[model samples]
Target chain A: MSAAVPSMPGTRRFALLRHGRLLTGAILTGALVAVALLSLLWTPEVPTRLRILAKLKPPLSEGLLGTDQLGRDILSLLMVGTANSLSIAVAAVVLGAATGTLIGIVAAMRRGALDALLMRMMDAVFAFPPILSAMMLSALLGSGRLNATVAIGLFTVPVFARLARADTKRILRRDYILAARGAGKNAARIAVDHVLPNIAGAILVQVTIQLGLAILTESGLGFLGLSISPPAPSLGRMLADAQTYLTLAPWMALAPGITIALIVAGFNLLGDGLRDRLDVRRDVSA
Target chain B: MSPLLDIRGLSKRHPPRGFGRGAGVLALDDISLTVEAGSIHGLVGESGSGKSTLARIVMGFDRPDSGTVLLGGVDVQSASGEALTKVRRQMQMVFQDPGGSLDPRQRIWKTVAEPMGLLEPRLARLQRREKVDALLASVGLQPADGDRFPHEFSGGQRQRIAIARALSTNASLIIADEPTSALDLIVQAQVLNLLMDLQETRGLAILFISHDLAVVAALADTVSILHRGRIVETGRTGEVFARPQSAVTAALLEQDAVSLASTDQLKEKIHYPR
Candidate 1:
């Protein structure tokens, strides 16, 4: 866009927009979040208020994506659904990663019996499939977005904690870390200041990838009637509702299904591109 | 002042675990030395000759199995948190691998200011910055160079930054463990000159550890030649180089006596890989 910065031999920097997949993914993610936020402020139809007048109207004259069986504009429902779904996923991931990273750092720094115990506990948690774990928790807490968020968040914690612990353990052995210890820095300061910054890039890449998985998991719960309950405009629930009317109104299922696929694909692509960008081996010149 | 650093019976042996347990590798065997204040004492040896180990012991990083390292007569063997901090503040080390020694994520300024932050917490943030800038300038780097990361600098520049960091704290003793090994010959000379200048102006005692005889010859006032973890020879740098008593020392200077000493089995190649 302007003057080119001198790059190391063989390391070429790409513009953010040049990486089409990542750019597309980021744009889609942002749009989804914006729509979701807007849904909170206003929606064309009260997602639950059933009105027979506009029922099952097909695209164009009836407006975009037409109307569902409940006469809710499919476009409007999508806006609300994207917001509701992403918010829950984001909240769960934030909570999970924050708590998990703390546990991981503590385990890495303290080590010994406590570290072994915590690692084993994390392993036990990891053994459970994310969906199955979320299902059980949702069943226990009853079907709701909050329950889904909590279940997903708890599940996500062990994943990040294990990653953080492994990375932190390796970083602690580095010469600078030893220097910090020699300099009389306490374990906490060393862990927070030195250890955390080094491993944060890898952790962040993991977080982004996990975020995609989180969205899919939350939607799956909704599809299974274990999240956000009925009447809420969730893409998963929409797909479930459209199942009975597949032959009659295929677009009902198609729109939301496509949204889910795109969102997940975008996240995966973004994560992949970022991993490439942040790669220490990949020099910044060519 | 009773020698700035005194060592007595400093022996460290790595237990050859697995199959080699019975074959004890005496990394440092009864290595004792005294470093007078305001003197540049060089510990010269071949690789695996225990020069690095001695530096490590002096810094309190490794405890000798049965030895005493005294920093101004205070035994470092049992120094705890506060005492160790105090000892470290009084004595600092500059490592061989500047890239490895520094936190890559940290800026040059942060690395330089770290020791000061640990030792002199009472100094205000602005004062610390001023001191760090001064230290950087003193090491031939401009004040603005502190803003750059370690990866941004060349090998020689990084070594200089490491030296600046070591000098930032008011350390009486600086153990430079092959501080210029990664640099090119010219840069190495430049760094050596800087060290000499610093020693001359600051009156700082330096323990310059290196396997390079030529480099050591350039800087060390007194040289201690270690072999198999023992100080085989110790004297003025010039005297040791001119008339090496041991064949191991002679071979180290690339003299023809290397093969002659092999007959005794005690004059094994020092095995110092560059």
Candidate 2:
């Protein structure tokens, strides 16, 4: 039950399959994940191999999508970059959501002094500008995707915590929760049977939104040379390397730029669509 | 045996708003009552007459400032662990708003089976399922109806589901706090009739709380009239109405006179506009 509601499984799937926003988002995000997973198998050419003679050769002149300033295949680099970008986002969001949701549930259940202290701490965490702190965090931790993911994950804590805690508190006041208690279920039992299920929809929506944010933030770090060094490739790093060439080679930025835009938009659409579906059902039941 | 349920010297004060300074409102003032086994004890009161506060205290959802609630000779206020569980199992409750009481997210069977699940954990899963079906049937609902959600039911059906849940644990006493207040006239009579039937069949006791004297007068064996936070008059239903000693009781009788027929009003000194 989501406080006491069971998971909305198959019912939403077929109905939502016909939805434009959800379909487009599913296709785009699905493509992103598929491309990332596909990277393990193949790419057009060796992404790290530098063809000195083919440097700045532009699209279609040689390999498809042409080459970067270093003469590496842009298509291959983009293919590998999806894996790098997605892994960082997924890992960071999962870590943050799990930790933050637990803290939020605890804060709500405990209430009083502990709740005040926990919520105030979350407020403090929220006050810190996410991008700047993530920048400093990755920079201090040295170079690597883990450093950036960890940094982004840490900052995401407050958002999920606030969401979970607020939802739990609201659902706790419901007569069913009281009825559950009267039925001989303890505080923890009600939390598992009622609180978690009811708060889940909100949490799921937040997680989707945060996945997009994490990707954006981690890319920002990579743009600053904080993640995915050398041949590993990163979309943000590709954009960074392309910026210098600018007028000389505008096509260098196109591939990575378009990919990032599509992925972020995909996540936003999916989150919004899920929220709409949840709202409609809630109104019906209400 | 002592009464199935008993409350002695129960008191509660709702603290004032904002920093909680100054004197608080006395929601219940040293109230005491008893519900004999297989009898209906109606708590009659106006809107602010501490009916809900006393219900909460007796249900052990909220602690009384000073009092002891004995359910079958066990002190509910201080019972803990297994004793607490037993107290919870023996004394079940039905709320005013059936919609609010049943979890909209849960299926009817699960809600009805919850108390049984807790109290009879050792019973086989299949046996529990059978029990749930039996409980649903006992409430005049089809067993298949148990698969549906609360949103799928009418107000009367929801109240029936709530009653089914109360009966699931084989509770000796059901604290029905305004169980019919949210229902329409016909449905209220049906649910009251259902309660009377359940008490008849199971030999259970009921602490029926309500704001309407006519409703109480029709069902309760014993009645207590509460005003503000104190019980102004109480006795066998017939005796109390025959001679109301308190002005508050007189007012309740007068207010409830609207529902009574012209003939009955002559003896009670009440007149109904035809």
Candidate 3:
């Protein structure tokens, strides 16, 4: 797979430029982030300002992407929605990856009883349907952005924990770990110093993949009216708003629907690209 | 004075394959050996002869069923906490594959300085860097080489880094488990020379384990021939190779000769030694 990556730094750069998935993904993701940032400062109209007369206006009739059922600018709502989605996804992923990776490594290092206990608990959580857990969390936390975040974040923990554990165990079997012990460094020190750095590639890839999933899961919750309570715009909320007027004003669904698709697709491609670039080099420990 | 490394009656048995302690393979059987303060000792065996098991036990990573491994006169098995940590500093190990032993993600200097950071906690960062540079120099690597990762270096260079790491704690003994078997003969010769150099300059003792009898014959001062978990023969390196007493010894020497004769045949086919 290193064949996909050139040996020379100069050639690597040239090859990276030619990587279509990475390039397109970067552009799409970059535009989404940029629009999210811009939404903080300005948009054509206040996303939540109601103007019932303009409701269900077709694209470019009143505002750039026209108005939704609530008569808020579709473009503005979608922009703010992008920002909200990104923040929620970021918070959830960080929470999940940190807690999960810690537990995973601890389980990996301890093994036997502790490993079984931690992993079985994680398995119980992991086996539960993610959407159900989100709904349950929304119920418990009382339906807001933090509730959505907590639900998505808690759901990601088992995913990251399982990845970190499996990868840590694999790395523990490596000769460098044995050499680390021979260096008079104990297991804890080796786990931090040696195992962490080696598993970084896998973690990074997992982080990117989870990020995309977080956005989707967050949007899904929003779609179910379990996220960021209405009047606060979201892509899923916008979709939900577009539902009643679908036949008469199909354009209402198109803008937020397309934007969400592009963002998710961009993140998936970026994750794939990173995996290709950061491929493990075939573990030359032969 | 006690030998730098003295292992006595070391035996290890692996638990049986299936459930129930049916029976275990005798991985090591009453193995005993010693290396003087400034000498090289070789442990030679075929793959399943428990060479690695002995190395593992000697390094205190694994327990022997019943034995004592004394490094710098402290019994490793009995040593605890500070004592065990201190004794660990006195002996270091080099594994068979340089690629496998060196952390690919770690810079070479950090790899070399690892033992020192653990054993010498008070060492200042600046002092550590200087000492690491000197260690790299001693191993015939450029000081700048420490900035690079292990994957950037060739196999020979990685072994040198491993040796430098072994030397970092000012270790009296290094248990090298096939340290050069992964390298080509030319690079192997260079690495062997480096080991010999360390032994002479620092009075470092090495417990060099390898299946290459020729390498042992060249490097070891005292040699032990391990066969099926037992040390079948022991003597001065020259005397052992010159006059083999045990059947295993004779057979090994014969095997060595056959390998050499095959090399000659290879050369003849090539038309020139070069």
Candidate 4:
């Protein structure tokens, strides 16, 4: 039987690439990832520099996007700051997905005491809102970017663990899984060979969605004065700093606020696109 | 002649505790059957008839509540890890729904070569590919088909690929669970014919499970009818078709007999048939 894939005005590739939301989101996310990776190598100015001379100079000759309240060029500060925020978000997502995927697999494979323990632990972790937990953690450890990153990363562990466990539970029940077990494969091999491959698409979709959520959460922490100390030029911190000079130059608060909104919206779009692409339900119509 | 596979009093019962609690459902009752070497025996039953359960028990995939499955007269129920592995090598299965049976991400070559990996270690990678190609060709599939993923092929082609995968292991017996049910009628006939041809050429004992009586009639030498977890009747394919004793068997033989609203006529036919 032939499938019925809906045809649009333009080709599928053209529609996907030319779409402003998808393209812009992809480009922005790609740029952010690249900048984050490259930050290990170089920065235009020492990120810690605090000079009053260059402070608050509007976007002009030497200072692109103007200097922040702390005299660092807003553009350079943003580049490194974007990298730092993204680094934490990416790490948290990866760590959370990996750990959660493992726990989910283990729970699915051996569903008795271990399953109960892991599930209860996940439930307990899920009991608290991630932001609240992060706030509590930052308050205890004092504020720092690393603390926020680690807190956000830790908070995400249960989210993934729950998704992975739920997805894996359903996947393990499929006929092919039964077929693999029939072939005399042990639990470990079946998990690795059969369960993991099938669940990967679902895992990928979840990771993308979680990536967006992670970014939003990290920015939220920075906005709450619980992350990146002071003068780090974080998007949230920049917005906080711009509040004092809101009437003088509304661009200060608006720029960083809009940047955060755009980045978050981009990640959200990318996640949605990925979900549509990776989902098995889409192929049923195809 | 001694039977190649003998199952005695195989009974599997679902515990009456879940959603359908308090209503005891017998998935498989005291059912027994013998499959001769180099023969194609078909087990026919409707949905929820426990034919699949029987296949699973035979293949060591499920543990029966009470029964003994003897493969080549060796008890498979008590078979340990390595013993189960050995049993698996002796008999492989080609599952229903070929698309679901094969891993979507794995290429056909790797899928075919996998069964051989655990059994035949000395078979080099290239040799395995060559053998896989030959196996595919035997099942009316092209060697190039092995490079593509499962989703790349049609339902019929995917079943042929699955048959090729089963053949790669060189097992003595094949438990084909509704191997052709998912295909179109024309494709189903082709796959059935292929199984018959393979059975004749290789002397492989096949335990074919299907819901279609007509399909079983075409290929199975012996036929067993299972109803609600019990083997109601079994005989030579022609004999069972000619003179089915049990009401379940008669309902199976006469088309539309099952869908008849009244059980009175069915009971009469079983108790006293013309």
| Model 3 chain A: ten consecutive residues of lowest lDDT | A277-286
Highest TM-score: give the candidate number.
Answer: 3
Ten contiguous residues with the weakest lDDT in model 1 chain A = A277-286
Model 1's interface RMSD? 4.9
**Which candidate achieves the best DockQ against the true structure?**
3
Q: Give each prediction's DockQ, rounded to 2 decimals.
A: 0.30, 0.36, 0.56, 0.33
lDDT of 4 by residue, A1-286 (tens): 2235455535766666646555676777786677656766777767667777777777664455766666766666666667767777888888888988898889878999999999899888878877888888877888887788777777778877777788778777666676666556678988888778878888887787788888788878888887777766577777777888777656667666766676677787777666666674411100
Look at candidate 2 and give me any clashing residue pairs. Answer: A1-A4, A1-A5, A2-A5, A2-A197, A2-A198, A3-A194, A3-A197, A3-A198
lDDT of each: 0.80, 0.84, 0.86, 0.77
Candidate 4: CAPRI quality band? acceptable
Candidate 1 lDDT score at position B155: 80
Which stretches of candidate 4 lie above 4 Å from their native place? A1-21, A34-47, A280-286, B17-20, B121-123, B256-274
TM-score of chain B of each: 0.89, 0.93, 0.93, 0.89
Give the lowest summed-lDDT range of ten residues in model 4 chain B: B265-274
lDDT of 2 by residue, A1-286 (tens): 4655455665576566648777787788999999999997999988899988889878999678889998999999999998999999999999999989988999999999999999899888888776677667756876787787877888899999999998888888777777788888888888888788778888988988898888888778788888767669999899999999989988889989898888899998888877876655531222
Model 3 residue B62 CA deviation (Å) reads 1.1
TM-score of 3: 0.93
All candidates in order of DockQ, best leading: 3, 2, 4, 1
Question: What tens-digit string does per-residue lDDT give for candidate 3 at B1-274?
Answer: 8777888999899988878566789999998999998889999999999999998888888889998998878999888888888887888998899888888888888888988965678889889999999999999999999899887888898889889998999888889999989998778777887888788889888999999887777778889999999999998988998899999999999988965455444333332211
Model 1 per-residue lDDT tens digits across residues B170-235: 788898999878786667767887887888778899999987776676677899989989999899
